[model samples]
Target: MKTTTTMLGLLLGLSAPALAQGLETYAEFPKDTPPGNIAIAPDGRMFMSVHEFYGHALRIVEVKPDGSTTPYPTDAWAHAPQEDGDGLNGVLGLQVDREGILWMLDGQGENQTGRIVGWDTNTETLHAIHYIGQPAARPTSFLNDLAVDREHGAIYISDTGDGANSAIIVVDLDTGRARRVLEGSQFTVPEDTPMIIDGREVKLGGNPAKIGINPITVDPTNTWVYFAPMTANSMYRVRTTDLLDTDLSDADLANRVERYGDKVTSDGSTVDTAGNVYITAMTDNAIGVTKADGTYEVLYQSDEDLPWPDGFAMGVDGFVYATINELHRSPVLNGGEDASLGTYRIVRFPALSATVSGR
Candidate 1:
């Protein structure tokens, strides 16, 4: 609800159609830190991960209505020692379920283990902790994003592995067991594509970044899980039933995968009840959608290059909120020198139809 005078001035300058489409700045961060992913509670509370790529101190914070941020849950939990088994290691994905549980995905860096922590917001207590280690999470695994399937009692994670060994990790919430699937498969691996941003190729460690299987989301019905590689041109999906079927062979599971639609190089995505997948089209500096008919369209294109739209969260207010962190300019992606301009943003627009909050 806090709209700065500068943002209001920018809004006044937008074209009529852009305003009519409902795209507008929601909040802005004037600091050097960058936010990675966002999760909205049914009561309108906003939480975001301070991107690990930037090596910031705070891991996650709750963005207040006045555009200020405070350490989420508690300062102790946010800054707890990872080795002490009481804090978040590296979190980039989180969501709130129908029961008011905020599930956070912690990809333990260096340790190479991953775990999902569920916090009960309604009671302000710890709900559950499910560790994903060993064969389920490879040494090179970079657990990026996740989709919660409440109907199936599971959580699906995209392991953007060392590019070549990328896979989808399915975790059984009931038993805390995990299985890595689709390793080295075309659907999970990135294509030989270069991410061209601002007329230059984005690179990491002096090489073109080939990130794989970054965006993952489940439909409103929780029937299908849609995901795609960060550098791929197409989206792919599989039924939640098939993903939870442990009896199915790898080949059978691979055969079950289907091409969803065409998507530009993107980061975060969310689905509406009408079966539309809203994408953060980072390559185009725009927000687009893959409709029910499998056709894609640009819904909102910002006049100023949207730094890097990173994550999506469907709010109870009927708007789809996203974080714009300018990640491509991070020191890790750039040549060890941060090129990001301050005043990062969290933007929102009206959803095409009803969407599930905390998605």
Candidate 2:
């Protein structure tokens, strides 16, 4: 059987002497199991959503360090309940705020974008993206990833749309005013196009299959921006001062973006306190890590056995967390059912311990 280990070794990314990287897989699921996004709490708990995206089950599960998992309270918090289909209103994006609040991106699968939700890490208190930027166009344009600059009292969101590719939507976390910035910079799209995944190319519904910079991670010091098109293999960055200025014209901001070293064709990425980037790669099927020197390393190559690694996060004790969504062969990306989809996985590894949290 072709496993993550063999495939990774076949790709020539594995290090010699068996990588010392200590990664342990704590959980697995059966067919139709899809893990949306992952976030880590200071309390050492790992939180993630389930079900195929677009039509979320609105279910969030918390995984213990020892591999046990429990359901988070979605029934008590979801204000917009879903019916008709077995949908929990897909929970696509998740992040932990500076204050330890868990913010979730609820993307309704009815061809409509959904809401941003917040759960108090300490008290389990729930809050939506209220008083901040709401969806620009609901039920269609959905919320994606989130970057909270609590230092500045602002939250930045990515709006992935159907007709419109995407836009950077900012919310005044305190006042609730939402503003759209950088609308048309090789980023947003007006029509749905075809995208290629694995060895097959498929169109996501009618949505464009091209890359439009979906995943974003801020620099530890909040001085720079790192992002990539979920479909592309390279990563890019720009000074955070440029994007946050709000006064800079879209052209000016676009010009400020600096192309960082091409790490790998990555999907989701996160940095530790030490400025090391843990990026997921479909082609590599391993976490392509980039250090401060611009050199890179593949920390663990499928030792825990993953499929289409996607999300990255650093939890308590500076451990790395990742989700294997098996997106590479899905109908949304590939053209049909892929063996990769039958089971879902979450893998963890102890990354370099540094205090870098991208804002």
Candidate 3:
């Protein structure tokens, strides 16, 4: 890992003035394709999933320091299947664990089933593949984001299932068993609030985007998993121990959920060692923090509308990197017209406290 001062100066070209201002542009991308989730490896390598909504040909890419991208792992794995063998299918949530294993959430697997792909960056080999289908996943299940709890040998996923049947799917890495918990519970369901951006209601398919349980993350110690619906005002959390317990019934697990703090409509989140939850406050065009005390504060606001601060990744360099893709302006949400300005960005700023690379 590079020192923070050297990284800010050499890699990002961030001046002292810019550092004080917050949210410096670290990288940029074209509007035709948008990045969904971001994951930074301990070695300072960055990876991102092409936002599934855009239907880009590339599912995942390794972003270089020069702002160029290459099909990650291999060209064959980054694109749709041509002949045979495995490839990433609609990957949204991805994180590089402490062991250098990149876990990708393939929400749209073959036949629209869901799966988790773990690739060991250290050995350059496939680590494991766990299929999350049937009773563990619903017909409308959109397995959006995931949190890798290395401490508990489990993976927690947020299945935003058509808003009505949203739930959390826990995958035991040791056994490759996935169990759906808290289905349709208040903790997983979205509130009635409408997502308003730029003073206009953001809608999808001519209806308010009532997305449920979008951003999911684990703390530095991997003790608690914090999450919230994309349209909700409050963030919720649960102990990893309870989530990994196979004996806990749906009702019993629901009782363990606790409201962590108040948050604005957000897309992604990551926690630090100090317990501050960094949120992509999309509605506010800023990055906000929910302190350990359960109080919220805006940490960095963009000069212009920041569009949608889609995902977050704490780099080894001590800065939190985020993707700024204008998702609300996409044709899917803009009534069949592309309203984007044709430029997207990845920005970074110093974290409030020391943090891990991937959350």
Q: Cα miss at 83, model 2 (Å)? A: 8.1
TM-score per candidate: 0.92, 0.79, 0.91
lDDT of each: 0.83, 0.61, 0.83
**RMSD of each predicted structure:** 3.4, 4.8, 5.2
Which tens-of-lDDT digit does each residue in 1-359 have in candidate 3? 11121113322433211221445778788764588888988888899998877767889988899888888878888877675666877888999998899999988545656899999988889999999988999888889999998888899999999899999999999999999998898988899998888888988779998889989999988888999988898999899898888788889988999999989889999988888898998887777888889888877665353678889998998888888888887777878877877547788888889877433
How many backbone clashes does every candidate have? Answer: 0, 21, 0
Query: Worst lDDT window (10 residues) for model 1?
Result: 4-13
Model 1 spans with C-alpha error above 4 angstroms: 1-22, 80-85, 303-305
Best prediction by TM-score: 1
Model 1 scores a TM of: 0.92
